[model samples]
Target: MLSYGFWNNKGGTGKTSLCFQSICFYAHQHPEERILVIDVCPQANLSELLLGGLANGGSDRLLARQGAVPRATIGGYFQQRLPSPYQPPAIEPLDYITTPCEYNDEIPENVDLICGDPLLELQANAISTLANNNIPGTDSWIAIIDWIKDLLQPLSGKYDVAFIDCNPSFSIYTQIALSTVDRMVLPVMADDSSRRAIQNAFSLVYGLKLPSDIYATYAFATRLRNANRTLPKVHMIVKNRLTQYMGKASAYAAVLRSIDRDIEKLMDSNPEIFTFEALNDGIVDVRDFQTTGVVAFAKGTPLYSLKTGKRDVMGQRVTVHEDYKANCVEHMNDLVGQL
Candidate 1:
């Protein structure tokens, strides 16, 4: 199975949201029938999307909100003892559940999700304890990943893809994710600030000395509009509250093309450098996901329809894909092709 992670340090960039959509896309499309979503983000948005609620009520949410204690999450999976093959829990752990179908009956049958606890942020201190030779719990970090690998081993040939949604920071949890992931995708916006975030993400990947195959990215440029000629040329742009500041098409595309050319130059200047795409609006349509996992599930039904292709360059009314949904699918298809 292919293990992929959708990551970016900065928030509000739609990292978890896109990850959820990709899981849905593949679950419906891939037939070999092996898929698992590991939600490492404390935000638990992906987890909630899959399971429909946070584990242990909203306690996890409260803890993450306060940043008080890192939840004894996957850390417990490392140290927490499990029943042996010969024991009661048997081949699979107890937390696994098969509930009634929410979306397509066939689709949910092929899907299984491991949720993230809000207190997962607490794993940092747990890792520190283990590093200092204090194995307070059942296992260590190495044990955690091994346990995870073992848990999924049964579904080995059954799965064709695994999507892991990691937290924003470069903490111990992310380290485990990086070491285990077969590939990684970074989603960036079109603005200068998002560009800096991508740079920081690149730094994180390089710092780990992870193989080149494991690090890759796609840029989803959104909320862009054609404005005056004074602004910088960029590859893509997102429309936001400040409509007054967007540039015109001729000027904006010119700026974006400049950025794209600069990136090509950067890659040529450094062979290890990665490649990126400047996709227009492709985010998911929010209305498609009405009241949880229950979707309309109808053909030709727009997936969260939004305004597109209407207004003129100067503050014209335009509707793009809801939120990078299609762009993510396209980018992931390319990544899968690489594997």
Candidate 2:
């Protein structure tokens, strides 16, 4: 299966959110393929999203007695608790049927989720210690990959994609997770700290001796701002006049999120990019822009052609403008093609 990890050193960069939407995107586009969602983060946001809360005991309680459940996680595969009678057999969605979740949505039909318990943080370190002490030929990283191969053994030819949601910081656990994956996608915000995170991400990629042609890497720039602001009319006129003499470079801008004190509207309709300013000002069109989430866009055919505006996929009208829809479609198309 093709593995993808949504990662950034910085937190609250929309890593988990992106992963959830991507799964929805693929499931809507290609419904036949099975998918595996592995939550490698101690926060377990991915797991929580997919599996909901734990049963009886909390997820941590279940993790404390990992051996009790043979098909609980990657660790169980190594211990040979999987449903497969033989070693390294293909993975089956039925393996995770015991996991608890309340998603009646159609997107999860082909998905089989492996929930992450809070105890994963401790389990990772314990495995590291054992590997360093008793394992002669293998390191912890290698062991992680071995576990992945076996855990997914039942799904050998069953899935087209595997999405791993990694924690923000690079831990020994992440080192193992990164070394095993074939491709990685970096989600970056258009700010200074995000740039440094990109640099650190490149360092990690460089350290891994992966094949060149296997999977292409790329950066998706989010949350931008226009540069030409707060200038006087005469200064702005002069700036415009000087533009002819200077070549136009790719102007970078960001949608000011509410989290920033400088940004007045975190979820506003204003086009953060400088280029979008002149086309339409004082009005924000949701269809033409790419906001926090785009999958909620309405899906329908032209009937009597009532312009109720953009609606959620359920065919009910919502307030999303036209610009946001266009940008999201274009961006997602490019991403899927690259994949």
Candidate 3:
């Protein structure tokens, strides 16, 4: 399966929102293809949003409440096997897979979820310990990293695409998630904090010790100037939560220019590591659909599926404007096209 991770060290960048929209659009575009969404965030916001709500509990609660046979979460897999580092057990992706649509017709059937759990926070430390451990005649840190990768190996031919929504931090879980993905989708806002978040993400990738085999391939690449190696190709740098209004056109343009300059400076500083050009056409700007997004999330429906009508919002009846719905669809299509 082709895996893509939507990540940013900084939160509130609409990372999860973009991931949700992208996967939904992908599934809608290719109904025959199986798509898996693994939520590796401790907050489980993506899990809750995609699965409808926390009340519509899935494998995470199934495993926790009933003490199910096989642990049914990404964190649970590591929590169960990290203790036996010398001989880690195998984990099947299907065992943890939860068909949210099967339970609720409102959801897309082609999309499956590996629900996230708050327990992942606890497992993060254990995974780090195992990764740093140097036990004689035992498994190496690379083995531990591979163990996490193995969890998703069974999904190779089963799904067409896998979208991973990671935590907004550089933890062992994030590292494992990053290692497995073929492409990284960075969602950043047009602001200073977002710029710093991008820098931090690049720094994190530079510091990480990827598999020796992978590292060997980039050893001779001239683009990577420093001792720190590069990372997987950044598929796109998305500018999320953009506000497009004629009233503030100049102001917004200035912000975009600022963001552009920040990206240029970043590439200049780390030429070898960030050789991927940040072209004007390459960076997608997803306009802010404030209330539209809220309605979509609340209804657990794709923005494209939303119709022009009145909908109840927290006991308040509100009209869903046709123009707003069209804008959302336009943006979604644009994002999918860019991808």
Candidate 4:
């Protein structure tokens, strides 16, 4: 399957929300293709949105999945894999899959989900230990990293495309989640820290311009390359939460331009690690979703499914301006068009 991952080392970058909306729009636009979404974040916010957001009983539904006999979540799949860290299990991969549209009518009919779980936080330490284990005749690290890949083995040719939502940290779970992606869609805000986060992402994923020679030996790129594995190329960068302001003289304009310049310099030096040679070809500027985003996310609804004006969200009347709603859909359409 052609897979894309939405990730950034920084939080508050609107990564999950963007993934939720873009995937929904994509699923709605292409009704013939079966879509899959894997939520690897411990918070599982994306899962909640998929199942039914706060207005609906999403948390309750998620809890039911988490408490199932097989656990019925990614953590449950991890529970199966922990006992056989170095080998694939005999269990069914589709058993862990849940169709979101079955629970929430707002979702497109073709979408399926592997629910994220809070159990991930508890299992992270033990999983890390398993990865670093010194097992004879088996590469513990690669096997651990491939847990998700192995799980998806039976799903080969089953899905037209897949999207993974990762946590902000470089934890063991995040490492496993990222190993399956062919293209990386990084989201960043208009700030200096985002610039640093982009540089950090490059260093963490591709081992570009690592600070010292000693670190190269223990870097992610080092280990993956040693195992003859490939790193996902940077396909596109989404500048999320850009405030609509007074043209190029806005307060965030300078920060955004600096980030672009930094990326362009990196493109010049590490052309092999990016899908696009030019920065403009790979960058998408999205205005803040604002009221439309708040309402859409609150009810587990996609932008395209939203009607302007007052919308009921759990007995609360939330006003969704028509202009704002249309703006959200337009931005999402633009982002999906890139895919």
Task: Report every candidate's CA lDDT.
Answer: 0.46, 0.45, 0.72, 0.90
Pitting candidate 2 against candidate 4, the one with the higher TM-score is: 4
Q: Which ten contiguous residues of candidate 3 have the minimum total lDDT?
A: 220-229
List model 4 lDDT by residue over 112-147, tens digit each: 999999899999999999999998888899999999
Q: lDDT order of candidates, best first?
A: 4, 3, 1, 2
Off by over 4 Å in 2: 51-102, 106-108, 134-141, 208-330
Cα TM-score of candidate 1: 0.57
TM-score of each: 0.57, 0.56, 0.84, 0.98
lDDT (Cα, tens digit) per residue for candidate 3, span 30-129? 8999998988888877766676643344334434522445656666676667767546576566777777676545568899988777788887777777
- Give candidate 1's error at residue 173 in angstroms: 0.5
Residue 293 in candidate 1, Cα distance off native in Å = 13
Inter-residue clash pairs, candidate 3: 223-272
* CA lDDT for candidate 2: 0.45
Q: How many clashes in each candidate?
A: 33, 28, 1, 0
User: lDDT per residue, candidate 2, 94-140, as tens digits?
Assistant: 54432332332323566766655455566666655544444454333
- Tell me the tens digit of each residue's lDDT in model 1 across 257-299: 5545545554455434342332322221121222111221211
